[model samples]
Target chain A: MSTAGESGKGVGGLSTAKRRPGRRPGSADTRGEIIIAARKIFSEKGFDKATIRGIAREAGVDPALVHHYFDTKDGIFVAALQLPVEPAKVVPLILAGPREEVGERLVRFVLTMTADPEAREPVIALMRSAMTNEQVVVMIREFLTAAVLNRVVEALGIPPVNMEVAFAQVFGVILMRYVLRLEPLASIEVEELVQIVAPTIQRYLGGD
Target chain B: MSTAGESGKGVGGLSTAKRRPGRRPGSADTRGEIIIAARKIFSEKGFDKATIRGIAREAGVDPALVHHYFDTKDGIFVAALQLPVEPAKVVPLILAGPREEVGERLVRFVLTMTADPEAREPVIALMRSAMTNEQVVVMIREFLTAAVLNRVVEALGIPPVNMEVAFAQVFGVILMRYVLRLEPLASIEVEELVQIVAPTIQRYLGGD
Candidate 1:
């Protein structure tokens, strides 16, 4: 499946439906283009410093068009970092599989989703922004808490803290591998890493 | 027991012995002061953009003084991030205890080192610099490879890749806890976390 197309289409439908004033009528693709620009600018300048006008200029659209498309920078960020498959949507798929393999599925999902640069950029952008900006950190924390972590914790019926620590370990490995490009970890085969990390993740999921 | 003094004294003695021209003989504390300033500037401006003159200006010393103390920007970076104790020095300390407990010691060392704002600043500075600057990433990768990681791998006799994976997990935990300050993980008590994480670290250190 075209994850990229799915991600864009999902947001595009939502924005067009909102039909905020000044959203150009014929510019069906305007929202998508603006999102592209937003991701770029936000990644470069981070969350706090990236201005709406700058994103609009990058998209070659007016500032009003940006406002029409996304109400606030936070709105744009939610849209920009939001992946094609929602955590809520994917969690059931993950949960439907064998109970014991959930950890492997989760590990493989993140590693595979972020395996490519095109798909990885938005994730990295969100993480990097969260790292440097306190405002963005809160927003991201709220987003993940709602969309991903909390859902997974509830599904497994595990302690939230345990799930968070599990996520932190895997999340850190991903950042080091993809973002920091740390050696050995960066170059190791995906399946090999999955094997090494999956068991620890399993323990985190259900271990005593 | 003063890590700050140890870090300063170690560098100062080396700088004075190098005896580069403009090395002010009377300025016994010049190396330490420059490191403090370097940590601040590198953290704020990042590694590639941070300049010797800028560091000197911040430290209220001459640019030549920075040059005398540190032969290159890389040198200052190494000195700045280099903790009070070297890995070579600490590896034996970590290895001297019960073999199974090494993981606990290593995990505790990193968590405790980064817990303090003053001690954590240089580490966070290096990590933040590494995140944004490719040059600094390579420099840091090399430093950790030689000074800490390689030594740990040697001591444990684990596959280098396994050792790296282990480090990445703990390293990521530290980044989230201290730098990003991710919730729950951030607030979780150190010993509590040590209990939660030590087993995983042990498995990485010794498990097949």
Candidate 2:
């Protein structure tokens, strides 16, 4: 299936793309290098200023190859951040279920995504970075608003504040459970957390 | 009230205590120095291991003077972290009001505490440090449990999990408002925030 980061001719016709000497397109970790470059550029320039050409140049690959792997700047940003789940994908999934149950679905999705150690690290890393780096926070806010919050609001007919508060609660749980690791909260069963937290989130989302 | 950092004669007797050469105990910012030392020690050792004597020695001040200014290890810790309010002071206030209004009181307390930029910075800094530093996380977890969460639970007669969840929501609001500065949530009026969030917190705290 030619996994996300393995040797293969580029999907966007970068088969003959020139690169720095001694590295073939088919052998080296082209995708990985691109992500590394994207991460650095994003950190330095934030989500808005970082560009495909810049990341491609930093990675020593053709820009087309960058596009082949990650279709848009947001895609590259998602890859660079190593997000647990794509906001583009998850927003739809969250919205697909009955509107009243949006809280349950949203809570379940995040808890499930973060339950795995591998899936959770990047988010924690991004959040930690966001705490100190105003640039990262702005980038995340823009990306999240664009990719997730705006879509949900448009589809569900809620004010922006509702989503923000709902997110704040979920964000707090993730921080408490994973980062701060406050007891009982940290070790509590996922079902228990969802049960306790979901109704409030529902109220925030769908309330009068 | 003597400003917390200002020089004053020790409340505890340390009139003739010896210290490292070149700094006078009565004339200098002894309280501030002890807090600096306490911050360093707490960073190095989790809450249980840090001691008043260790912080005093690190500050090149007498332990009695440290005791004079801040009466207990927890007091020193609260000062070192530059927390906006004393959990000790705040907890009792949160409990003193009608039990149903506890959520509103809590929401108001945190919103008011973090309203000041100077006050919020330390908390954000502590949260940022906690994300990367295991020692800091452990220290915070222990201290918060001792000074705040446990006390709230004991007085409210709710399961500890209820307080944890309530705290999680408040914690999330703080991070969202001050750190991430997510819009609507960040800029919403305090009264509006209290209205929207207090009910949920009240539910969390006093709900069946």
Candidate 3:
């Protein structure tokens, strides 16, 4: 993966279409090829202008093969971004914790995901794409609202409305500190950032 | 101005050619026209896509007219947004009152600007545009950092680093209540909202 450079071809000795020999029998290499191509295409052209056919051409696969793997452009997008961790899985982690601990967990989860060198690029790409592309923005917002925010609200036994507010506060902090990289906040240690922000998020989530 | 609507011209009634009377002789109407055109263009296209030529076309003026009035696209944007009231105007207002009142004033200023029906559209547009547009985002971040956050920190006499965390809290509240319009926060009366939120803002700005 690191060997793949600006030309979209893998560096010395790596075959672009080579799949691991012992992988699941039915899974085609085309799907992985399409996703890699899509990531490069989406990053270069953004979500709106990048076409499915273009991705197929870049991947050296038929457009039908691309569709076979993913249901829609959005499906391809989700796959390409490699957002393998579903919000469903993570949202429950925050909710299962005590109400006071939920904020801490939420902050920690975001920080941990973004802090990883490998994970950071895709997340930043997703955010940048979301900012520019209305469809991507809507998709991301729906994912956040449903899989993350709604679950947290339900778990806390709070009204949906209040829960959304709390989610906004939590997400806003994550955006500011991680995505936007606003000064001092960006540079601060994770523990201090979580400590200062968690209490406010906790209050929004469950306080009077 | 009211009759202009009946005449079927879009906002501000003056024809694309006929200069409005109130504006100064040569430069003022051109400047106003450029700004009005710039706002529409920027809102429709976002910052990166919006061009001076597009603005001039929208204004039905020569491109040179735009350069003559504003020099650069950013200058035009700054003028169009009419964010002339910088932190200098705001910081003193927040600081001049009792320390306890700072939160109320901060909330009031943000809410008042956002709540104004006429102002809301452009302000929200600026925010949305800022999310994707690097130049515009930089300008906004700079203003938020230098003018807004810096003033609050100086007034409170806190270490500069702490201000970013404080700002994240304050901005999160505002973004939720105002921009995202999340539930209970959205429905709450301004006074009640202020009461609930001001303490938090106060704490972030100056409290322990």
Per-residue C-alpha lDDT of model 3 across residues B60-169, encoded as one tens digit per residue:
77777567666666556666786534445556876787876777787777666666666556655655666666666655666566556777777788766556765565
Error of 3 at B176 (Å): 4.6
The DockQ for candidate 3, computed on C-alphas, is 0.24
List TM-score per model, in order: 0.71, 0.85, 0.62
Please, what are the lDDT tens digits per residue for candidate 3 over residues A1-208?
Answer: 1211233222223345455433222234556667898877866675556778898778776566566566456667767777745565567766776766776787777767766756666765665566456556545555455556667777777766556555555566666766556788777887777787676666767555
Clashing residue pairs in candidate 2, if any? Answer: none
Candidate 2, residues B119-193, lDDT tens digits: the string is 888888888888888988989988888888999888878888878888888888888778777787889999888
Clashes of each: 0, 0, 0
DockQ of predictions, in order shown: 0.43, 0.70, 0.24
DockQ: the better of candidates 1 and 3: 1
Deviating ranges (above 4 Å) for candidate 3: A1-81, A117-134, A178-180, A206-208, B1-26, B29-80, B173-192
- For residues A140-186, write the lDDT of model 1, one tens digit per residue: 66656666777888888887777777877788788778866767889
Which of the numbered candidates is closest to the native, going by highest DockQ? 2
The window of 10 residues in a row where model 2 chain A has the poorest summed lDDT is A1-10
